[model samples]
Target: MRPQCDPSCFVADHLKKVPPSGIRRFFDIVCEADDVISLGVGEPDYITPWHIRESCIHSIEQGETSYTSNYGLLELREQISELFSKKYNVEYNPESEVLVTTGVSEALDIAIRAIVNPGDEVIVVQPSYVAYVPSIIFAGGVPVTVSTKMSNNFKITPEELKNVITENTKAVVLNYPNNPTGATMDKADLEAIADVVVDNDLMVISDEVYDCLTYEGEHTCFSSLEGMRNRTILLNGFSKSYAMTGFRIAYALGDSEIINSMMLIHQYTMLCAPIVAQLGAMEALRNGNDELDKMIREYDRRRNLIVDGLNRIGLECFEPKGAFYAFPSIQSTGMTSSEFAENLLDDQKVVTIPGDVFGEAGQGFLRCSYAASKDEIQEALERIETFVNKT
Candidate 1:
């Protein structure tokens, strides 16, 4: 046998630097358990709408199985263009400014890699999505954290934003109608942040995957604000809104030059997004509105149910107006987020993600997704009440 090199040596330094996702450990534990209710994954509980599925099935039956253009199907791109114009009041050249990615996840990755040079610092607002920091690190860039507090409902202020940005700073990643916290920025607030971005001469990668799911207020697209469209990379997808996560379809929109740059990396690496998924997404943009509205109403009902249930049970939950997560402060249990989640799963067989997985600032909280059925949410709340009371 040949000599074995040090195991660590085989991996890239950046790959070694980042830890595995904290969410996955609990997922493994969940898969091994019986009769467990999981409020863990950030996925919708609904099925993809039948019309959208039928569109894809029709395309396949017609033998439209070949690769699409590196950009994407023109019809899908035009639909996305019309949606942006109608909803966000933003204009995008469907032929030039839109790049259909494998998912919003891929759009984010390619955007970061395309913009960041070695030693550049990317400001990441936390406690945000788990992927942002590691993605920055993976791109040979530095991730500087700007922690938003519960007092501000997790909206990053211009002051907090200014503190972390340095001369080496290249970009900022924003997620609103945010994950975990369910925080949303009002239009005025987003405009204020837009001013900071303009003054700083910075580029922004705005992940609006959850934008359409807002409950209390409208989601002001970052690109819709003055001067923002030139600098903001708008990322969205069918995963959350249309309940089509399995489709693996999303897109990035920006200035044509930046879109071109991302396309270069994407073309060489991914070639094209899946044609079947593109067809499904086209139908989703055209016919999925009613189904989306129904799901949103249901999510709102369950969101109200669980948030009230948690507060009644003595765990403090802020009213979340966006996304379907209820992040309840578990501090009174006197356990770290991990300890609380672990013990609750073991003792009660109810699964929730420890908030600290998102960032260090998430330590005192737990993210309980309300994307499950109402019955499941009711049952999970009941078990959580039991666990909290006995503790």
Candidate 2:
């Protein structure tokens, strides 16, 4: 029997234009293979440190399970305020300028929706996280992509940024210790870009989710820059730093007025981040730096191992200064990034994300995450070596 349906099928017009994420398609295939060693996922393999997890258990046992304030628990906000000041030299009033959301993911959505009007242009640097473009479009803004080259170590320059700016540009999205690339911006590089941003009066959405993972130098917060504090929305989370990805707790800090506006959107959309997750995040802010430092040290070791291993196997890889992923050029393989990734998964049972999944500019490269165990990383490297040699 044919299923009955509404004669007027309902779907938003934007839904037709929005494509499914390119990153997820490859991940789906990786999930079905039991023997696969996946270097494709972005999150760490480590469990959330015991102390942070125990805090949440304590909260529940104390019957602190009821809903907190819409903005989140005041104690958590106060903790975040102290941590930001101590670590990044940035100041925010927890009462008005800080907002706790479901994750950095939700904070990004709120910032975009609050700041962007329909048809406005938002500048995005690529290859970047998979979420930025779609989130911009969903807020009725057009995304203008600025491609960063491998020669430059994937760092976007002031000249490149200036070339893309125009009257319609509303915001510039910055991600340091970037996903997929592991590239970071130095203070001088940031100062150059800040000059342009301040001159143009553009808002900056700085995503520093991997701030604790930098290898070469300290991670500089854009909001900490001169004249940038009011105009920048800073996105960060417990997921990457505390190995609490499942907790889904993050926050946005910015000008009080801007944060208030975002809070309204957040209230309607998410109500509040999970109460347990917020408690866990608070504990992370209070006592998780040692855990973070330990993880960063491990990631640094794995980073060197993977980068050196790729070079030995004849793949030219950029030595990433931050984050856990390594982006390597696959030009010698005579295959596009997509083809190389698919064939590698099928032939070697090794999974990785194609750089082109990040953007067209990422075409001849692949991103391999070092967030796995040392043993798994070694095995994956051996398989990659064999695959390259045979091909």
Candidate 3:
């Protein structure tokens, strides 16, 4: 028998620098335990709309399982392009500028690798998604995080952006309606930030996966801003809005050069998103709006319930303008975010993600997803109140 090689030595150095996701750590525990009311996962509790699922099923029944083009099905890409044009007035040549990805996750990963060189500085807004920092690190880029305060309602200000700019800065990531915090920025707020990106000549990777979930005002697509069309790589998907997480369908829109570069990385790695998923996503864009609106309405209702419940329970939760998360300050409990989450799970059978898992700026908060059913949210809130009282 041949001697075994040490796995640690074979692992890439950049991969070694990244830590396991803090979001998944608690989720893994929740899976092992029963009778847990979980608000830890960011996924919607609802299933994909039947029409969307039916489309995938019909395609499978017809044996339409062949591998799609690396750019994904042209029909699907056209639908995606049209959706952007109709919704955000952002135009892209589906042939040259749209690259379908397995998920927004992959879209983000490829965007980083395409733009970043070793030691390139990528400014990440925190308490942002857990993947942003690691994606930068994996691409051998430095993640320079600018923390957004709760007092500012978690919106990154232009001064904050200017403070982080340096000669090494390559790009900035913008996610709003932001994950973990559920903050959404309006057009004026984004224009202020866009000015900085334009002046610095830096690329923008805008993650708008939760754009459809905005409750306060219309979502402003970052790429749609003046002077940002060519400078932005727009990433969005069906996971959050259309309830198609399992479909794994997403796309990126950008300058043709960047799209081509991203395709090179994606072709060699992912090859293409699944055909069934592409079909489902096409159906989503074509016929799923009514169903999506229904889900959004329910989410809006649940959002109100959870936010009100959290505040009534004495946890001062800021009103989440978008996405389905309620990020409430846990400082009142005199416990660290991790401790509060752990203790709540142990004592009250409720599951939440520690805010610091998203970033240091999230340290005194807890990210409680309101994506669950109304009953689940109510029960979780009750359990959290009980736990808080004891603490």
lDDT of 3 at 211: 94
Between candidates 2 and 3, which one is better according to lDDT? 3
- Residue lDDT tens for model 1, 116-180: 99999999988889989999998999999988888778889988999998999999999998888
lDDT (C-alpha) at residue 207 in model 1: 97
Off by over 4 Å in 1: none
* Candidate 1, residue 372: how far the Cα is off, in Å: 0.3
Shift of residue 335 alpha carbon in model 1, Å: 0.6
How many angstroms is residue 44 displaced in model 1 relative to the true structure, after the best TM-score fit? 0.7
Least accurate stretch of 10 residues (summed lDDT) in model 2?
A: 7-16
| lDDT of residue 271 for candidate 2 | 88
The lDDT leader among the candidates is 3
How well does each candidate superpose onto the true structure, as a TM-score? 0.98, 0.97, 0.98
Name the weakest run of 10 consecutive residues (lDDT summed) in model 1: 4-13
